[model samples]
Target: MTAGAAISRRALLAAGAAVGIGGTLMPARTGLARVPAAFEPTQRLTLSAGETELRLLGPDRPATRIYAYDGDQFRLVRVPRGTRLEARFENGLSEASTVHFHGIRMPNEYDGVPTLTQPVVQPGGSFTYRIPFDDPGTFFFHPHCDETGQAGRGLVGVLLVEDPRDPAFDTEHVLCLKDWRLDDRGGFLPMSEPDGAAKAGTFGATRTVNGRVHLDLTAPAGGDVRLRILNVDSTRVMDIGVEGAEAWLIAIDGHALPPVPMDTLPDGIWRMGPAQRIDVQVRMPMEGGPVTIGDYRASDVFTFATIAAAGRVRRPRRGGPLALPPPKLPLPDLKAAEFHSFTLQQATDAAVKDTGLPPEDPLAKALIDSLCVGGATYWSIAQQSWPTGEARHLPPPLARMEAGKSYRIEIKNETRYPHPVHLHGHAFAVLGSSKGRLPKHFADTVLTQPGEAVEIAFVAAPGDWVFHCHILEHMETGMMGWFRVV
Candidate 1:
């Protein structure tokens, strides 16, 4: 069997055996039926990734494999714009795992970050998710807990909710961009630094364009195409561009941006923090040319993919995606926002190594020490771990937003590593950011570097909301927290 296939089989078997072991090992962490009341929705469903010889609770299992977060291809099934989707999911992980659909404004209960919005679905148990598909466009679903390990293992999917007003395109595509840190055998290497958490969380070696190694798309001999790309990486900030083709910018992170012609290319790498999306239009060449998409940096080792335009095609007028109604709420005001300064600091290995804990337990000091590939510990929000109720203790922002109140947030990063910060339940405008206060480009998750800061303004939608770093690993260790609106 191919290496990819082998990886899938191993993951399926590992998960299958894990469920059985969970009961005898982490008895308390088994059977999601006992998930906290706050996390349990009114309904639940049974779900698994691959369809093979796998049992979420037994020894025999299917061949399901998880890829490092990279781009993925998805079909946008047309669904009524305001439809509510009720899905029950079985997190195919041994310990705990949950999924989050980024950029789709859903009910707080449906937001899938574990510990903050809910608990990780136990190995064999199930949980129901209720999300109102109020808005539509390119979005993603990924594990929110233990992001370092689970996400790296390929636990992400696509949720393409179509807008009723969205005009038809010759073709619609969903691409999830990600990379993997692997050895020759294709197994993932853990991200654990001995001294600094930032060092532990950085770019990997190999990059994948659509959850796989290479992408070769077949376009009509001559036609206009739409490519919706999302950067779901845990740490790599990419600069994307297209070669041998003509293109245009249609949208950004599910929000429609004024049409911009793609002439020079975006430094050849799509650079946005995790959960960010961009929609571009590429028209097939008249003479069938090779359209390449991805980076060409000196540091890049290979080209992600090439679109060979060699078949009969159609010619269509060039225009932006159908106009989307502005979000129901208005943008938040920065001036009136409750300004808060946050810092991303690293934890010392000495302090983390010998917590005076035992060795056998995975949660014990020595066991966790052994797992410390780099001795990195994802930071915490206000010093509180996730799925905790610490947000209640802190002072609320001054705006005292109602269910529909708009507010602004200023996020500053004190360390050098970049972070993809995501907010639940609302689509906010990136007002601008700087060390003190400067206007930067508008973006959802600003990949701020050390000592860099950015400001985001958004109207708060009602529901329990979460805001945290998108560095999957950092989030898994601790860098996560929540916000609630009653």
Candidate 2:
């Protein structure tokens, strides 16, 4: 799928079977491929990544040449929750690229990363990914190489895993919110400037929902509906809320969480960072009206979609928010777990003293500064930089342990900006936060607020697992590190 393209799996119309790409909304970096390509894939598709001229600004403005997936701005891939996905991806772009299924806990080998999990699918060549979906939730896919450019140009898609027992709704909508950086002629601009990549990621100039402006939706009056919203923008964080109806929060980051009162949040708006997903249930008014889903985070508040009741009035489906079956995840035993800590900081900041590295370290502290992209290194974990390119250094394990052993990692972010941190192979329980105790839930990616600390616990799995910030450029430049569980 291309950047502006969309995909949807609308309730299967009856059951668990997912339909094709049509609707919805929906982030990675490098490591080595652990396995070799050997067999023909069970499902094969060709994805071409290149320039596509888009009339985004206006008809009189010059068409902008942006990247896309399979000629679409975004590709939609839908299947049942447990389907074994064996798809071969042929890279047609001029540069190196690999597909990372953001938020899906698949086997390490199939988790696309150049040199880290799998080698980049070179231009004109191909790579096959085979994995079965073990959890049902809202997820997305994009490049792990040159992500700031590849994804910025367009290459992003929606991957939906449907659960048969999920609550039924009269209709469903997938809203992928993103921003684009364009010139006056609607032409391209430099993806990332040094200052931007080092600080809050480069923000786009134009906002879009599912590749278009002013995308309007329709639902029956008083009908139950599900909204799967994703923030695929490289930098902009969103505070989303409904304007015309009361909405119930269903899930967070694809994990099933009990419905919480909207009042639990500020102004009842959900704050979604990069790569975060929120599922909400909204019932249209008994009388016809437009339920506007708007993003109020920016200076200029705007409506992405208006769910208008154009159809005949229908009786409400259920009396309350739909309940979902909680995932049977491998939760860690906190009492017996070994504890470790890492502080997130910027490379230039002198406010905090460095600690993790010993004087005898093989990768010198100054060498870490050499790996900076765009001429400056910006971020770090544990006071160490995970440099890219020839300086690509996978330093010693943050914590080495035996497989299946329980461990708790305290992740602290002292920077003034927030980062959506992602773990490669295993799902961990969000144990607690410095702000206060948080409800425990399993996730592969969790957001860390600035000046806050979060602790996550998990059973150690055997592998070289990489953990890093999900802000593409942030990872590419410095905020990436890994662990080894043998």
Candidate 3:
């Protein structure tokens, strides 16, 4: 069957029986109603996006001109679970922009997808987003329009939803890992290169953590430290691991997992792609020592940050890392779920189909066109490239489903490079993979290996959700689609 084509009910049941994929067939529940109706804003804040100067190269070098939210390269917005947040975003740049709350399952209108959910916030204009912190985990927000140019220039921030039930650590730190494409004078290079976007994305020349060339901090000896690492880079994938400290992999993409020893994982490291997050608990040894965190995927191994065990011992090290509270999400009934499939591959002119779609506003189209990096379409999903510059209409959704219905989606990566497939407005369980075994966990983005097939199951949330590669270059070039849940 073709991608996005629905399987017959009888065939679906037969396949489920043959595979023994078991789950209780429960009545579909309206998941949208789970969001409280009388949520009042507990906190209000304003974020202004504009160009800022930062000495990215070094103190002796010229400051780089980059875009940032609230004049900071790494801004942290913490909202406690069960509370509501109202944030006003002011676009101070000369171009249009929108803020997408990555991994947050909120109302569709506030999703921040320009023209899809809300119009672009033009220059000097503002838009307010009312978000409910229902699920507590490590999430982020970034511009949905001109993603490659905007995000690569540093328009990204980390959003942490505090879960009161989560265990408190002696020291907690959040690291935002990103790369910069800068010249010797600290000026930005081209954000996207046609040849790079057509294949693997263009990698940045420099790497940093929390916008600093080197990050060093002190922690109490014999104490447990929680490190929340986020890969906010537009193109780079990192193999993150810690040295000189015993650490446990406690979470992935914000959601908690059974605490597993980092040493037990493959190669004692976890591969993190763009827009992915990982939470690790490190136990400092009694004696003073430096615990270094670095990206092992690099040729010489880049150490981005280090935590020294200095101050007096806070407490004796615990036996194991504490597990975080599981998020309350609707579980998918795989037995009765509808099946759909999508293939990620290279784009071709003949693959572009005219799906009946509504005409886009001329102004919005112009704004999007102006921000587009190039006129070439390089990647696609299910043989359909998302409409870009000069396209008169928006692309139709890859699939449409009834609200609250269970769905099992199989995404096959047919390209030469890995793609981190991200679905907005809902979190899905990684069922399994054809290449290897996967840990039991829930996430909004899954990094699929080239030529590998991965399956994910979730209960459809109400809204028009974007499904695309997390690699910003691939997404902008064409590897993007949407799903409509009515």
Candidate 4:
């Protein structure tokens, strides 16, 4: 009866049937303890690694301090600029954890999503976070509750939200790409949800950049670096490139893109997927050595990371040291659209083992034995079962959308797995893709894979909208859904 905050379930069975723990009444189990060490005045950053943990998505009680990196690496102790982060989350895993903050725009009650904004830190319990970095740039943090087994058991980290209009770098460097799933003697590979049904989840063949098996960097001789790339994986999709270094693309996924002198991307690589982020600017090579950037599309050469060249230089002043403030579109218009469509269905292996997070892979167990053989009964959209991350349906309230009107959404995937598709607050545009004519782009989130379908035009600004599928176990099982504007 410990873990507090979130209530209900009939008030925890009326306080456990007035204290008896008997029949006809149950529940009474909130968080299961640990997360009370507090400390939020900012400036106390330190997130060690090797075995991490931190939970606080729902049923909040005390859990924070995620630090687990088995591959590329993990460590983010930033808490200087504008502070206000309230700490206290430490999981050290054995299992059961939570702590997301990918793109921190806080307050949907913290937006961690595990039973939707709270509860489920289990294992070594502990959850207490109160972040508030006030919009900087190049953000990241992982483990949105069992996110394909704790982000493939490497958790994840790399959030540099300190944009004092950032522009004084002689070497900023932050690259957090991912992928891991080894056996035959590699190590670190403990994630589960092993098929039973989120359809497509577990993915890793061993790819790294920050936790390094490769991925090196060392520029000072000719100095001028700033390559903040992030692609915290859950699925897979990468092509990435850079060879003799002279790069210059500024940004994408995390905004700021106008320099475009980083040529050499003739689709030779750098194609990404799964929560992407990119930023570049390089020009170093005066007899320091290695310089390749990306590879491994089967066998192009196999590099992953490298950039040494530095003998004794500092000629950097090439492009004015600053100019990254031009991305704040906040779109919304298309004759007040409110249209909606999301259909990504395909569950079997006995409906992914009845949604318990693991079990199905013979083509999803022969399509769940041909749809339940004779037991039928599928019809799903809002019957709520998987994670109930919140927002099933709501728009008929006199057709909603009032506060500043302007909306348009049309997403359709219909199964095969490939949905980056996210939207909360505002940021939309890709008004071209019924599977065709899409070249003039602007995206907040749009992948749609499979049967593919897209059309997003935003401007409906009220609030309470979610629209999921950033993978995270397919929004924790049901693929999620939400809406509201008024």
Best model per lDDT: 3
Which portions of model 2 show Cα errors greater than 4 Å?
1-46, 58-60, 349-375, 437-439
TM-score-superior candidate, 1 or 2: 2
Scored by lDDT, model 1 comes in at 0.53
Pairs that collide in candidate 3 are none
Cα lDDT of model 4 by residue, 215-321, tens digit: 56777756677888777766665666777766766666666655565454445455556776778777776654566777545565557677776565545455433
TM-score of 1: 0.72
lDDT of 2 by residue, 295-408 (tens): 888778878899888675545664677866787667788899999998888876563224443546432232321112223457788877665445544355566677789999
Write down the worst ten-residue block by lDDT for model 2: 1-10
Between candidates 2 and 3, name the one with more favorable lDDT: 3
Task: Name the lDDT value of residue 238 in candidate 1.
Answer: 60
Where is model 1 more than 4 Å wrong at Cα? 1-46, 49-78, 191-196, 200-202, 264-270, 296-298, 316-330, 333-402, 435-444
Model 4, stretches more than 4 Å misplaced?
1-176, 185-191, 194-207, 210-212, 217-220, 226-228, 235-252, 257-306, 310-315, 318-320, 331-421, 424-458, 461-466, 469-471, 474-476, 482-486
Q: Give the TM-score of candidate 2.
A: 0.84
lDDT of 3 by residue, 1-486 (tens): 001011123224333333432222111221122335676898999988898899888878899988899998877898888778888888777666778899988877778776567766666567887788788889999988778778888999899999989988888999999999899989778777778888878899888888787799878888888999999999988898999989998988888888888888778998878999999999887875699999999688999999997775645854667888776888999999999999998988787665644455222332332333234678899988776545534577799888999999999999999899999989899998898746778999999988899999999987778899988878877788888888
How much is 108 displaced in model 4, in angstroms? 25
How many steric clashes between backbone atoms does each model show?
38, 24, 0, 40
TM-score of each: 0.72, 0.84, 0.89, 0.31
